[model samples]
Target: MSGQGTEPEAMKIVLVGHMGAGKTTAVKALGGVDVDELIESREQRTVAEIFAADGEGAFRDLEERVTLELLADPSVQAVALGGGALASRRTRAALTAARVVWLDVDADEAWRRVARSPTRPLARDERRFRALHAERQEQYAQAADAIVPASHVRRLAAPIAALEGMPAGAKLIWAVTASADYPAYIGAGLITDRRFWPATIAGRRVLVSDRNAASHYGALFEPVLTAVRIAPGEQSKTLTQAEVIWREMARTGVTRTDVTVALGGGVVGDLAGFCAATYQRGMPVVQVPTTLVAQVDSAYGGKTGVDIPEGKNYVGSFHQPAAVIADTTTLGTLPPAELAAGYAEVVKTGLIAGGWLWRRIAAGAAPDDPDVIAGCALTKLRIVAQDELDTGVRQLLNVGHTVAHAVETVTGYARYRHGEAVALGLLAELRLAGADALRQQVLELLEQAGLPVTLAADVDVEQVLLATTRDKKRVGEGPVPFALCIEPGRALTGQPVAPAELRAAIMELVG
Candidate 1:
């Protein structure tokens, strides 16, 4: 809270993100200036117009000059970087002294924000902006010491105030409690934040993370808590792993108050959550959901469990966390396929509680867009809050997931990322004739969103059907009920059908 209410100073803080991630808007706000006043340029032609006439190289030169001149002026209050500028070695080096903040936006919203602008040089007639945006996400992470959630931009004062007088990358407090009510504070330095680790875990806090996450974020957890590394992948979500985690907890003599930190993606979250829940009948768990999938779906809910080989999520408990920290920074390290897989939950969230939000995603919304994530998360939170127990209303949230989980199980989890499988399942579930138009529209959106509408070439339809039969959700002696799309906003649950129809749905995906 140190840097607030004071007159603007030197260029001590820098805002970075992919193109059209609202960095420019955020910078203008921080400088207490309007964009109209700052940009006294060569005719307000759209970036497209400039690129069409002068070309990309010309635009890049202009951009570089604008960036360099701004960074040089000590009086420059704050600076916002165009996405490509950070890619330059010289420009990045200049930022070494400043507190760099990354404005994380999803792909669809990124496209939406830039789509309205005619002046974007990058958006110039690029149909592959989705793919390209996905490609550059990791690059943005390299430049940021702290990631500022775009969702918090509207409520800028609190987050910015939290950043005051701290070191360049010191963590800022950013908690979201609308529905699930979780605490999250980010930045490279948050590891030391009194708020980051609960006093509940006094003598020592034990953190469990996978190999991949340990390599990246283990350092952050190690100094504050005793972190134990585990292997990665869904296979790790097993009773054996849970026992190992419990043994570590027991060996450490962890108390009810002592916390267990689940430091990886959903698998870690699920396994660690289950371990924490089962230990002492329930222990406080702090979820640091690393992957996009965990952040948007698995991490927020109190539902934690491990999958038995017989089925997914077979044994578990409702172990809510003291806090759920979603560092958008971690998502920057995710691979392209992993990124796409995360979007499946985003799509499902939109389908169920997201009335208009589904339309946004169905239109091939960008993940770098904050609005898309906000809308999706808000809807998801609403549903999760209502059905924290998931008996009735919240069941709609599984629209594509019934078939999707089956797909993952049958394909042996390694074949397809959960989101990719869900994307395909969404297409299949949407195919029940009544929602044909909407189904086609969704398929088009999935394609535009750089996802697969059909099953993978290697997937065995028969195995998937067998897995579907084994799903715990099966009602009576009949085909398992699936949440199907009646329209964009309306989804029907418990829609029973003949086993043959279910097989045909899988067959259609295969064909």
Candidate 2:
């Protein structure tokens, strides 16, 4: 086929998702050039006919060729991909420069749409169809630059237009609630924005950050606040460090009206927030999370505390920030290991949310993508809004954290990253909950994300059990409230499990 010659790199919009995700329909509704016309202009048979005449492998090769050709055609503005087309790494790699949109559809609805179609080879068996859809959903997520849910497909024109018009480095805001509500901004170069500083931060601003974050971005905050750099590491998240910050705040004449900015990862955010919670009976604080984990999870909720020797987060309070500024560009400076660790929380959020977000992460979407990070942050914010006190639905956020906290405590927070322990914790908890299929899927996703899937050899199982007994989730002399996965996007929280069963699950992780 001849390529459209000598045209500027026109923005090619590609629609991707599971079978029956309405990609083609949406593309048609989008009222752009007919992608199928271009395909038929090159080949005689449709994708379905090709699959029926040959096989999946043959169809995949043709799909890749056609997709590449279409993407190269400057004349083609929008195209729809077959459900499994993105499973080919070559196809995905080729489409990287194109504007890819994922039509996020759940398996049930997708099956309902395509079940009666005779030409779909992969949709023949119900169980197999669901599994295949689940698997490919992740691939679509990874390949997509934007995600439009199936429900929104009919109205895809507006969002697609907006995406086309959106400039790079644009800021998106999500409202997060703790004791008070605040805005969380996700974008590049937000530190330079004058509006990032809330009006409440007028007096004696104190910026708390770790040495690593301070060295890189400290100058941005220097113009406004007196900076306090703490030593970086999980061990530094303690009452002693919090006291040091408290003393510094006092010495700096930080009054109750002034704001304290937690300008690092979870450690600094927690410790600084704890100080804000206790200092002068609670001063307003702002969270400027620099790490992926902090951006998505810890920075939103009002939960703040330093870890005690007895357990993690043993000393803390529900001190919400006045605002949370998640400058996604800061993630560029994060080590690969730290980035992978942050993905565990993303996975955990997916399991709790169980829809497009879960599918996106399972598909290996870049953890640091502003939209992905914003989705996770908003998920937490919605849940926190409902149960700010952690008394009800909010506990679902702890799906993998029960044993995760124990592992952190038993190993003295040195052996594994918080998200790594959480990954292992997810597996054990899934096994304990008898969600074997979901467990295997999550295991594969973690492996793909380069997260640790098993407990370290030196980690003492007995010590982990001991730590669990003292977990804050445990009510007076009863079993700890464990969040157990029933399936993707579905979990039963605060479930009571026998000590023996819990121990057995923990032992399974000992590799």
Best of the candidates, lDDT = 2
Candidate 2 residue 13 C-alpha distance from true site, Å = 26
Give the least accurate 10-residue stretch of model 1, judged by summed lDDT. Answer: 1-10
**Candidate lDDT (C-alpha), each:** 0.68, 0.76
lDDT of 2: 0.76
Query: Mind sharing the TM-score for model 1?
Result: 0.62
Quickly count the clashes in candidate 2.
3
- Cα displacement (Å) at residue 317, model 2: 1.4
Candidate 2 pairs with clashing backbones = 138-363, 305-316, 354-489
Q: Runs in model 1 with CA error above 4 Å?
A: 1-204, 368-370, 498-503
Q: Report lDDT (Cα) of residue 398, candidate 1.
A: 81
